[model samples]
Target: METSIRLEQAIKKLYIAFHNNHLNPECCKQCAVGNILDNKDSWKHLSDHHGSLELNYVGKVHESFGRKFNGYSPLELLKIEAIFLKACGYQLPFHHKNSKPKNPTHKDILFDGLTEVITFLCELDDVTNIMDYTKLFEFKNDKPLHDITEASA
Candidate 1:
């Protein structure tokens, strides 16, 4: 399957968000989920998996969907966002609260989300055969660290 530019951008943004949250959680307070919900310009290129289904109201309409949280943490919101994004065919994964992590830490939530994003990208590249391996290396070596989660200008 030929990958779309939109998907490519989305995947890159996911990576950017993951590193941003990992390196500076304070700056990226909301992380990827916050970026998805609050920033329309950045995420508008990505398409929804379920057409006409409002993300905010998904739990209300679908019995399988989890209920909304009034004051959820950034990690919790990220998991919910992953669920909806995955349902929309983005290859994302929702980390259920039930799963037991091996090594628990204050940053465990961010790490879990990062793992999902990387897995999604790897699977996407395997299917589409479009990933540039060197770009990741370049990103690691050449890209200056920044607090902003958005891709380098």
Candidate 2:
């Protein structure tokens, strides 16, 4: 179990977790994310899952076909999350959210930011609770942690 700080990887984990019943719409903050991942088109305020993404609705319709794969732009996604966490009141079980650094880098910081998110999710459900932070391995390539079979077998 390695800590997974990569945003794409973290989203991958959530996508897998949601599909596998490790997460529930009633508990997790990402049901909308899962909906987008699954290619469903729907409009609902962020309130149901705890209202983390209502970043000033100036007629910006947030919909994704799940074709784009990555649910939200790294910057957009993290900001929405901050809103979610703020709405959640930054209380017990979830660690206090950190203000993201302003310096820019091509490398994604959202990945690193997910550690706290996973922690927050864990506080909400069964799937998140068992997420071994150590199991999130990192590699600098486009390869799946290992060949598919090698990883599972």
Candidate 1, which ten residues in sequence have the lowest lDDT sum?
Answer: 43-52
Q: What is the Å distance of residue 70 in model 2 from its true position?
A: 16
Task: Give the alpha-carbon lDDT of every model.
Answer: 0.40, 0.38
lDDT tens string, model 1, 1-153?
575453455556555655654322222234444443433322211223221123333333332344333333223444445543443333332233333234322355555554554455445445533333343444446674443346444
Cα lDDT of candidate 2 equals: 0.38
Query: What is the alpha-carbon RMSD of candidate 1 to the true structure?
Result: 12.7
**lDDT of model 1 at residue 3?**
56
Point out where model 1 deviates above 4 Å.
Answer: 22-29, 36-108, 118-153
Compose the digit string of candidate 2's lDDT tens values, residues 49-139: 2334443342133333222224344224434355333333343223335432342111233333334455544443334444353434544
Q: Where is the poorest 10-residue window by lDDT in model 2?
A: 103-112
lDDT of 2 at 61: 31
Q: Please give the lDDT score at residue 116 for candidate 2.
A: 48
TM-score of 2: 0.28
Instruction: In angstroms, give how far residue 118 of model 1 lies from its true place.
Output: 4.9
